[model samples]
Target: MRLLELTLPDAVENVALDEALLRQVEETDGQPVLRLWELESYAVIVGRANRIERNVNVEACRRDGVPIVRRFSGGGTVLLGPGALVFSLFLRVEKDRHLANIDAATAIVLDRVLTPLKGLVASLERKGTSDLASEGVKVSGNSQRWLRSTFLHHGTLLYDFDVSLIERYLSDPEREPDYRQGREHADFVRNLPISRDELRKSLTEAWDARLDPPELPFDLVRDLVRDRYRNDEWTFRM
Candidate 1:
């Protein structure tokens, strides 16, 4: 597994970078990967096949000047911006069982990437096929794509994001269906007790024991975005 830390300008680049990595993992039949980074600004991302108008509050986004983008993977709508930590895991299927369904695929990610964050209160657990919860509240949301036996797992970690902005910008103003039973952005999302570097170091150390590290030139990710993600059709395809 190669570990890569990328410091990039927050644009629509993540979507393209994820696609490129999925292709690279399939092409080389590579080891698992732990790719870490952060968003430089704000962006609204919806799942593939989601109706942008229905899933996102377009008027709220427009009023707030928030850019909306779509990801190549499937998951609920989410907001990414500064104070959010993003991580993507690229893995090669090791067994037939791991390729069977989304549930299993997500379980694998939870075990590898989140189970070790024990110091952050409680260890993470799957809230659904693509969510990680701590102390009965969600701390992260994930999405995945499996291409030719390779898995691309990407998600956002709310280290210290603006919880209030979620109510202002997300399509769900009330968080009715989901937040009915738990702490949500406006009510509870908070900054971690530890620093970004410390948390990252802990995450990296946990990943070190799982796969071999490879130095993927940052250029590969940079070039893919310029050619694909920063396009109007890809961002607002409603």
Candidate 2:
């Protein structure tokens, strides 16, 4: 897999780029990609099917000038900022048989992630469906999106996040894994006990992914935002 380390200035553009990259992979039928990026600022990203009002504190977000946008994948809402590292994997469905089913797909990808995570922190386990937790507190959360020939498996690794921000801007998620056990965000989530470089290096080596440039239809990202992600009509359409 090829690796691309790129993040846009605008938070919505980063979300749109997630869809754009997956579509680009389908168009090229190229190598699987592992794109790692960090948001320069703060944003509240809602899952494709999530109810924004239920998952996010809209008044708090607006008061703090945080952009609330929706992505193309189904999962709970997430808060993205400089402290978080986002990894996006674009893979060909035919390349991996596990990609054909949703549960298996999530399993295989996260199982691969556990290799490096275990090395970084002890007693770390794959809890629930797509979360990496240590001693029952989540450090990473993931979600997926599929197309005809390719799919996207992306998630946030809380390498150095501020947990308080989540309490301020996000309401209690409507959907959660059983392991969460109705705990508040502050109690349920924690940052990984690893530096960004260490975590990035481990993931890159685990996947055998080499760093690459931004070669995949950059124009499509802007178009995606213009047509869908950046528009409040589409973002809040539910």
lDDT of 2 by residue, 191-235 (tens): 988899988998898789997754867699879888998788888
User: Tens-digit lDDT track for model 1 on 1-238?
Assistant: 5777765565466666777778787888766778887878788887876777766778988887887877788777888888888888787776445656677777766776665676564645666556766655677788888887888888877777777787666654222235336544555444455567766776777667344456454576677666546666765675
Candidate 2, residue 113: the lDDT equals: 82
Give the true-structure RMSD of model 1: 3.4
TM-score of 1: 0.82
For all predicted structures, in order, the TM-scores are: 0.82, 0.97
Off by over 4 Å in 2: none
lDDT (CA) per prediction: 0.70, 0.89
Q: After superposition, how far is residue 105 of candidate 1 from its true place, in Å?
A: 1.8
Evaluate model 1: give its lDDT.
0.70
